[model samples]
Target: MNFRDYLLPADSPRIAAARGVTPAEYAQRMLATEKAQNLQREWQTLLDEAFRGITTHGKPQPDLFHLQDEGFDNTCAVNAARALLATLSDEHHQRVCQPVDAQQWRAWYNPEIPFNDFGVRLEQTSVATREAFRRLLRSCTSPSGFEKINHLMDANHFLGELYDLTNIMNRWSFHFMIFGEPSETRPWGWNIYGHHVAFCCFIIGRQLVISPTFMGVEPNIIDRGNEHDAILFTEEERRGLTLMQALTPVQQQRATVYTLMEDPAMPPERFNFADQRHLAGAFQDNRIIPCEGICAAEMSPVQRQLLLDTVAAFIHILPEGPRQARMAQVLRYLDQTWWCWIGSCGDDDVFYYRIQSPVILLEFDHHSGMWLTNEAPARFHIHTIMRTPNGNDYGQALLQAFQQYTEAE
Candidate 1:
């Protein structure tokens, strides 16, 4: 489908309303709206809840994650982090660094203008600082992962160009922050977040945990006939569709949670304006989302491989070593995993699917337009969330284990 046809006019309410305002001003106005305020309150309540972590049920299963060293050296990443910190002024450095367990790590949000403005915003940074941050991103992620982030950011800029809203959606509009100090012997990592993207990484020695990541886009491509032209999410979108098609008719029937994206039969809590079909977005650190589809044990070997391939689209954000470690973790829980879908699996259909296990929770959703004015879910507007369920997100469990071992020693 051509996304260009769905673009809103320059004078449309969504575009015109924010034309003269700065990103922060626009954020203030949006946050004051009833819907935004209500969501803020709900987020506050979720955060206030005791953090047992995201779970398939009420309680987290024990000993699923440990503090074993995975032999993945991140010395280069640590050096890059130091480089970025070195480029910052003392006042900026203070704003850019936080304790490993600081609450800001969990405060990430996926909006064009997020209300949580506690990090070093790239747009406001000097050229040297931005370059240093880029080097750090390169060090921390796989090559393709870094490229995907570039494309997502560029797509944000392209969308801004489409509606003349660059003030709020520029390519460099992301916020970056370092958590704890950069160290080889200690645990620390970084978080970068903004419109349609949020990634949290926590590391201890040779082990790296990158979870609670959110990546998405509207119109998913930059088609200006230049070097910047790019597409996003094709692998993820196609893999999800392929897996759904590979299921036998009976298996598909069992896996389909609802035949419609917004089914009347679904409970009220199943969908909402901010998150739509996603149950584990920002501030949902401790949500109890029960499994709702066919278990992985029911799949044939080939079908199971397809499921893993689909998961790899999300997990590939990690470097090769950490990706392998994560895949091994997911594989260990295969029998207990569940795959579920909402909406039809027909080719070209907009839909949502989730893969949940004791160790991982992934949700991919095609959402109704927020700026372009589509009243129904569309392929052009997609949202995907990856979380480490059962107390491992942000590597909190692993960090706890490491701390205990070191303290005892």
Candidate 2:
């Protein structure tokens, strides 16, 4: 909520000190002093204005997509979102969903953000409704994609056990929300968000853009003997290493910015001091990151494949059709992309790598302690994100393009 309601009077000592005013004889200061900055009004204003344009009702399609062609087919996903909405009561519908243009679209936070008041918490919802929501998740993402999300949740629960926190930190504490009406012809999106995980999937006709995705965890492994080899972020870690090894000395020299990752004393070129470990992380939707590391065109054929494969590890999370469409875009921009790295290229070294292109930006980093006790950044702590820079995240760009195309036609 807006904090304006709790604002102190203008004449308050703290306010006077901040404004460099001596609170002259309780005079005109009263006018400005009494106006305590509160957020309750502004908060509601944002809520009411969030999704004012998107239609309240929508239908299947209006020639915005050609699912039969080389693009995407979102019929299943569209139906699933509609099905989930049908299962909800009017109260739940109002609470759990947002309009396509809602500001809540940008309100998502990974574990990095402490705000907990947004989105629909699945565990807090009725059982029948929760089950129906999962069905939508299943329909939108592949089985493997859904599995990875659940694993992240369970890892959050595991962390809670170590930290002695409440059930709010449990595996099922994830939040869900839909933006825009579920219509085949219209552009809309949904988000599944919570600690250590935030998936922003947007749909514009037959195209999908899943970006500003945040995936990370503490104690990145499940130590339970029951589920042996329960690990996450390994493919990302391994593929990044594979690409680094495939690079020649000259290429590595261009890509490797620093041997000691995140060292404050390191030169500005060696590390991004602002983000510390990961750039384009949470709350960084508008970060301007110039190309770093070596371009894919500079790599050997094998190294290029490794780079593309590493990218696939993130894009593969999309359903088959959308994944293929997005992968095609990655290939189209292969020459323009940069593959940069920090930290060690040694066999067992904690490191960071970023892949950025005109259409995509992916970051993988081994971070130091936040939830864990590790002082040095380790393989056990991982953070990875896939973003579409240049304001295309959430398919907003594509939606605009589609609108223009139809208007011109």
**Candidate closest to the true structure, highest TM-score:** 1
Worst 10 residues of 1 by lDDT: 43-52
Mind giving the per-residue lDDT tens digits that candidate 2 earns over 1-409? 1112232444555334324322122223332442311222323444444221111122111222222233556787798888788877787788778888666766665652234356667666777767777777776676788888778878887765554443446666777889988877788889877778888888776767777689988778876667633789989999999999888888898998776776666666334322356767545555456677789988888999999999988887788887887788789879988988988888998899999877788899887665554556777878888887665666666666667878999
TM-score for candidate 1, please give it: 0.97
Off by over 4 Å in 2: 1-73, 112-116, 164-166, 227-229, 265-275
Off by over 4 Å in 1: none
lDDT for 123 (candidate 2): 64
lDDT of model 2, residue 392: 68
TM-score of each: 0.97, 0.79
lDDT of 1 at 111: 80
CA RMSD of all predictions: 1.2, 11.3
Residue 196 deviation, candidate 2, in Å?
0.6
CA lDDT scores, all candidates in order: 0.88, 0.70
